[model samples]
Target: MLQNNSELKSKIDQLWNKFWSGGISNPLTAIEQITYLLFMKRLDELDQKRKADAEWTGENYTSKFEGQWIPPEYRNQSEPEKFAIDKRTLRWSEFKRMQAEEMLQHVQGKVFPFLKDLNGAESNFTHHMKNAVFIIPKAALLVEAVKTIDDIFAVMEKDSQEKGQAFQDIQGDVYEFLLSEIATAGKNGQFRTPRHIIKLMADLVQPQLGHRIADPACGTGGFLLGAYQYIITELAKKAGAKDLAPDEDGFIRTSVAASLTEKAQAILQQSLYGYDIDATMVRLGLMNLMMHGIDEPNIDYQDTLSKSYSEESAYDVVLANPPFTGSIDKGDINEALQLSTTKTELLFVENIYRLLKKGGTACVIVPQGVLFSSGKAFKDLRQILVERCDLKAIITLPSGVFKPYAGVSTAILLFTKVWGAKDKITKPATENVWFYEMVADGYSLDDKRNKQQGYGDLQDIINQYHARDAATDTDRTAKYFMVPRSEIADEKNNFDLSLSRYKTDVFEEVHYDAPDVILDRLIQAEVGNLDEAELAKLQSGIVRDLLDLKGMLG
Candidate 1:
């Protein structure tokens, strides 16, 4: 829906520029401030919707806004003073009607504290909200932002109704578009993966309900959210719902709450998890999942590749695009990772492998260097994947996939852990590894990343992966093919997983005119106005030059 909503995009742009001009120049900070405002507005909207539903169905539902306020300063005061101020005034609906200055004071003084105390003192939201500050700085900017957000939501509501889309889907799109703005600003080493690529990875993994899905270096929780949406869509299909329709961006938006039973929804909420080193990213990731109906998102602020994290073999499915350009402190590296390297990319890959339970699958993106680097650390890691696990597929992505932020070529590695009994080393279970060369991902490979119709290979890659046949499908020249493990283990290849190493070029031959015939044609074309004697002289001179050149060569 965001693809077709020009007005919405304009409004968001206006809001972003307002923040920039209003002295909030940092993109992440600006986005956080906007997120807090949007959350406030959405909280009131959701409460009202629930109240109406409860009234219609005669169900008992308590609204979070239906309470009284006793400020910490007045808690020990007289009863009259303690009960004097109504907590309802802190609600967005009530305060939005007040004067701009009054609204700002009320939100900064009361509403933010109220949010920090939501769910309980132990809730993740409250824990993260403890450090949240309202930095809008002026009543006028806050008012303008609130108005623009209202208009944005209005457009989203209309689009959702017309397209049968979940409102959360539209909200997620709005958040993603905002994040893409961050990518466009040239924030090095910190960029959200495109949604279509996330969806493709989710489909390849095929996550199901009750499966613990995690992203160790989740940026805004895109991959985990994709897996959540995929599971919900599959549940809908199984329940006989209509086909999930694709939006203009080619993403299928489905209402998980409407399609899934309460139990299934609970399982889904508990199954999704994420971690990020940046506290701001953790907060945004939490808000991202919570806005999508995951009541309690399990996202935390922790460097997952550090020694402090000990959650090995705890997740059933691991999906991540971890930071690929940094190295960790040698003292901070986890002892559990046997790979000898501080490269975050290689260490994160090993960490992902360690985090998976036996038989658990993982789909991760890494730099192209990880596939075929001749370094001992790189080759050792590749051997661990090829010999110790069921290394499934190697998908080489274009260098421009993360363009404008990083042009480092990347690839997706799909494998499953297979630990032997008694901790003995196990033989490689991989007979053949599927390889896919993704030339286009539905978008141009430039900084603009404009969508190109009928050019993306995502769906075709997914299809060929599922229908892959090792015995009969032996064309190495095709985009999709398989290579045997024995060939991968050959000393000459050094277990190189790059597709180009195994792919063979098919040469086509062409015929050309003889040199004498070509020279005769050229002479005829140039000697049209020359006399016979002149033409003969020209031919004799050409022959004499040719003879001299041939003698010199000899």
Candidate 2:
């Protein structure tokens, strides 16, 4: 969505430059700091709107800024009331009116502390905010940032009204744009999954309302947010709302406000959960969900692969693009994960399998190597998917799908747990496995990833996957086909799930002259057997080419 709006894109670029020029060079740190400012602004605006709503309905409403608040650091003073400041003064709307120096001091000394404690001690956002620091170094820089953010919001509001897009969605896109500036990869091969790819996985998984959804290595909660948006869009369609439109990636989209009923709001508060080893990611992810109207996101700072994480078989839907880090410390590996290898890609897939409840579904992205590797662990993982679970589909993505961050060929695994069986397969659940080789993903395959004219195979993948028929989709020569489990599980195949293993390539037929005829033609040319007129024409052509070259050089 932000891609189509050059104005918004420019504004985001300007904001990024402001942060960089204003002493914040690290992309992650700059984004986190920017998130805090946005939250502060959004908090005040939302509170004001709620107040107006309460007054309109003649209801009792308590605003977050309704009373005086004491900074936690000053609470132990003998005369604590002397240190108290009016909560109203700490709001973005109020502080933004101050002089640059005063505003900087107010935000650093008073407003940030208030925001950190805004959700109270029990909230996960607050838990993650404990170590967060207000690090904008100068007053002029703070003033410029606030002005740029205001301009951005104004443009977002205008875009929302003019284009019938959601303001919240645009705001979310702004954050996503900010995140795209983090050019460097994180520890353990972690990087943000492209939002469109996440949307594709969400559609295949079809996370339902009230279904506990999770991402074990959710960097910035893209998968969880994708599922949430999908659920909201589905709800809007069910409600018969007519404002729904397809996003840039061709997925149906609607304003969260369209179907955000009280029940959905309540159910959503508990539905999406995520974990990441990076605390910064956890914080940014929580804020990301909150920015999109999820009041209390469950992203936290814990490595799911660690032995300490004990929640197994707890989620109903798992959508993840776990880091492709090759290996993890063997000692830190979770015991419940039955995979014996320390290969992070394999172990995380197993961890996802364990995280799903009986009959639960998981859509995960893994490097293509995991599909056809000859290693025993790779074969064993594929065996569990085919024999113990209802292995649904394997979609091979082009290697360039992750360009600029990685060029590793990857595939999506869509499967469901069956009867909660473990260790041994009581019965083989997969009769056939669906495979699709996606050649393009609606963007140029280069590092820039410029948007192309049409979405290539994205809409087709969704439509075909939902309408896939095992009986009729048997053409091995087509882009999509079904492969029998027996073929995949055969000893010769070694449980290889690579799409190429079953796909048949059809080469076009060509006719050529017999070898003797071609050889005679070659000899005729080499031996100068042509007529005098033909030889004269060839000599003239060579002379003309030489003249042209000499003329160009001169």
What TM-score do all the candidates reach, one by one?
Answer: 0.89, 0.91
Each model's total of backbone clashes:
0, 0
Best by TM-score: 2
RMSD of each: 5.2, 5.2
Give the lowest summed-lDDT range of ten residues in model 2: 542-551
Q: Estimate the overall C-alpha local distance difference test score of candidate 1.
A: 0.83
lDDT of 2 at 68: 85
Error of 1 at 214 (Å): 1.0
* Model 1 residue 5 lDDT score: 82
lDDT of 1 by residue, 1-554 (tens): 45568888898999999999989998888998998888788888888887898899798999878867555455676674744456677677788887899888988888877766666668988897778888889898888888889899999998878878878888888988887776333343555788888888888999999999999998788998899988888888888887577755565557456657779988998998899887888888888887777878999888988889998888889999988768889999988888889898899888888888898999999889999888999999998888878999999999888876777899999999886322667467677899999998877899777767753888888888999899866899999898999999998897999999999899999998876666556555657688888877876786556545545645
* Per-residue lDDT value at 146 in model 1: 84
Task: Give the range of the ten consecutive residues with the poorest summed lDDT in model 1.
Answer: 182-191
Best by lDDT: 2
- Distance (Å) between predicted and true CA of 517, model 2? 14
Q: Please give, for residues 163-218, the per-residue lDDT of candidate 2 as tens digits.
A: 88888788878888888888666446676788889888888888889999999998
